[model samples]
Target: MKDENIKKVLLLGSGALKIGEAGEFDYSGSQALKALREEGVKTVLINPNIATVQTSEGVADQIYFLPVQPHFVEEVIKKERPDGILLSFGGQTALNCGVELYRQGILEKYNVKVLGTPVQAIMDTEDRELFVQKLDEINVKTIKSEACENMEQTRKAAAELGYPVIIRAAYALGGLGSGFADNEEELVKLAEKAFSFSPQVLVEKSLKGWKEIEYEVVRDRYDNCITVCNMENFDPLGIHTGESIVIAPSQTLTNSEYHKLRALAIKIIRHIGIVGECNVQYAFDPQSEDYRVIEVNARLSRSSALASKATGYPLAFVAAKLGMGYGLFELKNSVTKTTSAFFEPALDYVVCKIPRWDLSKFRGVDKELGSSMKSVGEVMAIGRNFEEAIQKGLRMIGQGMHGFVENKELEIEDIDSALREPTDKRVFVISKAMHKGYTVDQIHDLTKIDKWFLEKLQHIIDIDEAMKKCNINTLDKELLRTAKVYGFTDFQIARAVGLEDELKSMRKASLVVRSRRKNYGILPVVKQIDTLAAEYPAQTNYLYVTYAGVKSDITFENDKRSIIVLGSGAYRIGSSVEFDWCGVQALNTIRKEGYRS
Candidate 1:
């Protein structure tokens, strides 16, 4: 049955994008608003950000361009009197504001229902002490830590936890006010910052080198649950996920480890009574197969957006429907059309997400990345293999990098020190070290990167070295095909074959390489992303270009004119979700006109 009580809904919008919170919320919020409109529910959205698509005309019934603070939201609640409110679509800002409003009894006074996860459940996840206690009831293994509400308590907890403990602010987002302290002096400085952001702080044993893995899960009101996607960080535990390269469908985990974590994620979400979507993070030691729950985000997060695009699962949209008194079986998967929302998406390709950081715009900012997030935006690339996916992701970041190899050389005084201390230029430093005849095992030992990934990097270096020994004409079709399969673009291949000086211009050399590759019948094929891995017949517009595939999964229709709508590349400063909204609107118009987009 449809929800009769949810005649009108108030949607909280994440305000202006900051360091920790970026355009990911804009994507999630827009999706939630679209879902509400589909259900014929009138929507009132309050966001000061005019540039967002959710604030655009027709996305919501009413738009309030006001601050999302508690007092401001309470006044709007008193005036609008919306029957329900959605807090999970927005980022930490909206979640925090909603919690504050609930604490002040504003939600109860207005008779407004907080949709998705219950307020108490949200509180359990936000407060460090409460989260630990609730998880303990279910026998879940969380980090060894102590929650402190005051400075003295924080000191005592740190002392008990021993030196080199990590301090985290309760209810913080994107790892804000979080850092590792090796001594009491560092502890006091970091704890003061942590206390400023939140009343409660958690001091836990540092798990610096453990592998960080994450799962995006969804649960309906009836307790039907599924894990949509899981991602692994290329950089280990110390660096924030937002500052590391992330890969979906974790590559290094054994089959046993993958299923174990998936089961644990479901158990934790079910025990916590998450009504919609949530993401669970874990720090696992590969050698010992031991792990600890890092934290759980009881709402759509940055990883939620990545997971959605990665596996062609609309997580935010499905979560919104679940919030509206719907079961997973009640809703059909919009992308697959033949499957229910209860079905878990199966991926046939790999996806890599690389963060985009614009730290140069700031003055005297700390360049070293740690627990706190420093990236402003991110890019997701899809390929048939990890090598191709990561290379595409590295180039997609728009950091002037031409994939992993063939980048401008870095001037490092000591390669070992550079690898030991990771900065923004660490990846390039690794490339430089490889050029200096560093072995894969040697680099892996120093940087603590997994041997699998390091070996892949070495393979790319080996290919580049082989290419450098040949000119463009001498680069046979087999070598060119191999390069393309590894996600090397025409430009990168041309430069690798030493064609820059011969052609007088880099663009011309790339054109020559492209023409040669096309003549050799080694072209990219378009493949559709079927959620079931082609187990059953399904149709979807989600697609990616890959050179590894021999045949295209989809065929083109020449009878109808196809309109190609190019979307804004990665989210960054000055341009963000608004551009994405424009592209989506264009596609909608094209589809309405009976033309394929």
Candidate 2:
């Protein structure tokens, strides 16, 4: 029943920028407001983060800078008498609050409808035992797990699952209160913390080295479904997706494997009856076709934002439309504007998202990347290939060092041991190991990172070696171009050539490289991320810079005066979504001031 009688909708925004819940919710919430307003519906947003764009004047019809707890939301509902409330746009904070409101009959008391996926469906996915039973009913393979209420039950479940089990709390966000326990002592300790987060804890068999793959699935009330994007974690199952380096449109999966996972994703979303955007995670073994359904996030998640940006698919916009009782075919792609929302996005370029960890800022904090998320921010970079993408992503992380070529002098006795332990600097450590003559197979055995990625890192090291053999004057245009194509900055090239002052060498090299490039008529061209990869005429401005091709796809119009609003690069601890909110507001102000943005 497509009932579109929604007039005034209340939006719950993620309260404050924290580790697990962060700016992604701000992005989603902002998009949801735009979506509702576009449909001629009035929006009332409740968020304490005054720094958010959604809370800015005019974004919402009525803005209450309040907390997202159930009491406050119920009060808002009673006072505003909204027709509907959207819980999917915000992070776990809003979803949990919505569930509590539904349980307490507050929504019913105020006659407010919960838009998007039903509350029961949300519960079914959030509760481990319910999720397992539901998947089992649909003949889907899931990790063997048991939800326990007490320590005794948790102990028994862990013992049955054998040593090395994963403990997860029911309603935790960003894998909070989750970890792998190798023994009873570890299990007890982890479960104690996990139980504090939620009433129930899940003790499941650990698939430590299995490939962690995620699919951003969307569905409508009419059962129309499509995958917006799929991502693969560079680190295996042991690491949280937020803390690990992730790549979109998984590079390791075979064609058959990709389709198989896609089919499974579609099946899971349909079976779960997810009415908006949902992210499905899977653990797949490379040795065979064996795979296990890890879990499903029945809301707009951090991965959803990454997927949207990576593929140029406005997932939050489409999700908000779907939540407002629109079917997939009823809405057009917001980016391409020509394609329907039902069309699955296709990608010609690779996107690498590296987590930015600021562990050094803290004292005595563990730097290990594990089941719990430790990254405060992340940066996404796009390139034609994995090597280029990874290198670009590393630089975009705002870390001091350039790309993967810089050595982090570690006095480690065993390289394999260091690689085995997951850390924020593991990628750089692996690069240093490869530079020290560690083969791909050796590193693979230690780190469990795919050999394909290792070979790509080796390629970077090979370029560094080639650069080392050439002086600034001797560096040919072809070699310099090759280095640039693989995502080496001018400073990195200067460093590789044994320059004392990298800034001076970079300036000199830049001049020479520019003159040589002019002589060879070699230059970078901007390309649009049209979601169709040029298969269809897409009217979109989303773009990336690449030197692989000659023809520039962007055409500038000089008639209008335009201003560019630079966003805070990535979300960090102290300055997060607040800056993003500021950037969004600045763009809005620029447009309002009669300037093109």
TM-score of each: 0.96, 0.96
Report the lDDT tens digits of candidate 2 across residue range 1-597: 345688999999989878878888888998999998999998999999877777887778999989899988988888899999999988999999999999999999988988889999999989888999999998999999998999999999988889899999988888889999999999889998998888989899999999999999999999988888999999888999899899998999999999999999999989888999999999999999899999899889899999999988899998999889999888988888889888988898899999998898999999778999888889999888888899889888887557888565555567777799988888878977888899999999998888888899899999999999987778888888888788787667777776535446556756655665567666788888767978898877778888776787878779668998887787776778778867777887898989889
Cα lDDT tens digits, model 1, 254-373, are 999999999999999999999999999999999988999988899899999999988878899999999998999899888778888889888888899988887778899887888999
Pairs clashing in candidate 2?
A: none
TM-score of 2: 0.96
* Cα distance off (Å), candidate 1, residue 37: 1.5
Q: Rate the local accuracy (lDDT) of all candidates.
A: 0.88, 0.87
The residue-level lDDT of candidate 1 at 475 comes to 94
Model 1 has an lDDT value of 0.88
After superposition, the stretches of candidate 2 with alpha carbons farther than 4 Å from their true spots are 408-414, 499-506, 558-560
Q: Which parts of model 1 have CA positions greater than 4 angstroms off?
A: 588-595
